[model samples]
Target chain A: MNLFLDALAWIVAPERFEGSSSLFVRLGEHLYFTAFSVLIATVIAVPIGYLIGHTGRGRELAVGLSGAARALPSFGLILLLVLVMGVTNKPAAAFTAFVVLAIPSILAGAYAGFEAIERRTINAARAVGMTEWQILWRVEVPLGLPLLIGGIRSAALQVVATATLAAYIGLGGLGYYIFRGLPLGRYDEMLGASILVAVLAIVIDAALALCQRLFVPRGVAAGRTPSLRTAPARRRAMVETSTAP
Target chain B: MNWVLDNLDLIGRLSLEHLRLSITPILAGLLIAIPLGWLAHRYRLARGALLTSAGLLYTIPSLALFVIIPPILGISYLSELNVTIALTLFVIAIMARSVADALDSVDGNVRQSAVAVGYGALRRFFTVDLPLAGPVILSGLRVAAASTVSLVTVGILIGVESLGYLFTNGYQRRIVEEIFSGVVMVMLVALLIDLALVALGRLAMPWARRPGRAAR
Candidate 1:
């Protein structure tokens, strides 16, 4: 409790907010690493996920690959990359870890989003003369936006949280405080940084959840009258798995 | 290759330690998550709050949770207990949601029939609902196992010994082969656990594996 109070006080102290290594500066650097990695991951993963989801090819392989990718330990990967690549360019090593960590969630999100759409609705769009590309962009992408955003949400939180490991490799981020504080016994600083990280994750997830709710097509959101075979369990499973990182 | 061969004994010991650290927490987590999951599923009022809290807990970074646990629990920062407790918390947070979802996936009519047949609540849960929810719960377990295996590598950063000791030591010595071996070992462990769990899931849920059954 004392540590918590000290952390709260440290967070509000004006002196703590303005220096070169101020909490705000570390926070900025942390967000930079997170946002940059997520951007690159989004660029790489979203397209691959989109292609696979749209064509329905390689779905099994992609799922297996993403699972393997997710299973890679972030800490181990960072250290391995840094060791292999040499410590001269630490950001490259750190970013690679972050990017790898971010990819599986985003990829899962993107493809799962596409898969969540009703096949009948997609066929109806095609029947109306939409080309493959048109159907993809016009029909699938819009409806899948919610899941896409949800995936990004998961990826962003993952990157933000995992980016703390970057400090281990001497890269600047909020993790630096915790790493430095541990050896120095600076509990307030360590706890304060952790609080920031937890709050950042929660705030980001909440925002994305809101985005998911808003982006879901109203017709789909407000389901049709229940038939005898609602398949409610299956539908719930789809939503649950798709949204999970 | 020569270095890896020479270090085989050390690797074997570390691997055993890693397994001990990773597997214990997962088993403990399963025991804790099932009841929590049951509570979340059984009560309408508790469902939202339970799920939300679990979800929130899942969002905490693994490293952060690891560091935070010592202070909260009043354990030594370097204690293996810190890693075990944190990983257990992680497994519970993740598995609880999966468990609740799995229980929800059990057919309503099947549960109704069990009730209709005069089985007591506990008997029905064990004999019917649990077996039916087995596949999904097992899938969640696979994830938890793989994740825990991978995460045990992080224990090295905090001065705890595991496979990650190789990575940290290798980094300090600038020994590329040592780091490579560590990474490879962790991946192998993760893959093995994932495959084993998949096989176990298949064996436990024979009906789910049949053709024309639900495609998991």
Candidate 2:
């Protein structure tokens, strides 16, 4: 422990931590890489996932594809990209992170959203002169909004964490601070990075929880609230029914 | 074909190392997480803290965690113990969540009935709750095990030689065969571990063998 503390002290002592500008720039770049990848992935995944879920035409294929996408290790995929893209962060880190992080949430969200809708509800929409597209836009999508948002929230957090790998390929994120701290025996800098990552994750999670509350059906949120003693019973019923044949 | 024939021994060694590295941490993680999760299930406050902590841990990048740990612990990459700690952190968080969720999913009436009976808290938990929660916990373990196997590959970046070392080595030398071999080997190992977990789940939780009956 003493050695670790000594290492941390050594890393931060030179500057007396006066250089906030460089730290901010590095932080910005890291956030940029993470946010951009997640944004791009969300754009591509949500619509396609929604389409598959609503149509039920290619749901199996979409689910299988997403599973396969997830099974591929992120590091292995990044290395594969680095081989072809030459590792300059543009096509390498961003695209790889997008693929790894996007598919699962998108598919899970879409499936949950679609599944959450009562079959009778869809039939009701269709019987009332609603076009298939209109039903999707007006009925199914809104109902699934909570699950969809939850998926995106999970994916976004995951991407931010994984994006730190970009430092290895010379893309320069907060991971650079971490790796630099490691070799230089700088425990403080390393701790700083870890703390920053943890804070970012918690903040993002809290924000998403707020978003989920805002968008989820009122009944669902009410069922989850502490004041509702019957919430657990309802939650159990929901889980059982969803898993039931 | 020549490359395969020449490097068979090295490949075998790497495969063994891969299993050793992956399985040790997962088993250790399950051991710690299941108990911790059970504790959380017994206590409401513990449940909230454990779940939130698990979520936070899940969101931290595995690579960054690995890098950050060595400095804090004053450890070297060469130490197997250090790598185990890194991998265990990832596994514990996921497994804890799974265990807690599984226990929570058990029928409330069953728990109340157990309490009404002569069975003590520990006995009730062991005989009734754990048995009922087995499938959900195992499923979570399966996910954790699979993810751990893949993440173990990242340990190579910090100088620990698992299958990931093969890809890094191959990339440096521009040897496509080595990279391909690494990727294939890791995938195969991952699949095998996943299958083993599924089989174990079936044996441990007979309820899971019957569709539509097991708790999610």
Among the numbered candidates, top TM-score falls to: 1
Q: How good is the docking of model 1, by CAPRI class?
A: acceptable
Model 2 docking tier (incorrect/acceptable/medium/high): acceptable
Candidate 2 lDDT, B1-216, residue by residue in tens = 555567878877987898899999899999899888987776778888988887777777776677557656777745677778988988999999888878878887677677677679789889998998888888788778777887888788667888888777777775656766777788788878878887877787776687655332
Q: Between which residue pairs do clashes occur in model 2?
A: A8-A187, A8-A188
The candidate scoring highest on DockQ is 1
The runs of at least 3 residues in candidate 1 whose Cα sits more than 4 Å from the true structure, single-residue gaps closed, are A224-245, B211-216
Measured on C-alpha atoms, candidate 1 has an lDDT of: 0.82
Model 2 has an lDDT value of: 0.73
Each candidate structure's TM-score, on Cα atoms with residue i matched to residue i, is 0.92, 0.84
Model 2: per-residue Cα lDDT over A197-245, one tens digit each: 6666678778887898798767656756764664343333223322212
DockQ of each candidate's interface versus the true one?
Answer: 0.45, 0.34
lDDT of 1 by residue, B20-131 (tens): 8888898999999999999888775677898899888888887777666777788877788999998998899889988998888887767767767898989998999888
| lDDT for each residue of candidate 1 in A81-130, tens digit (9 for 90 to 100) | 88777789788988988898888889888899999998999999999999
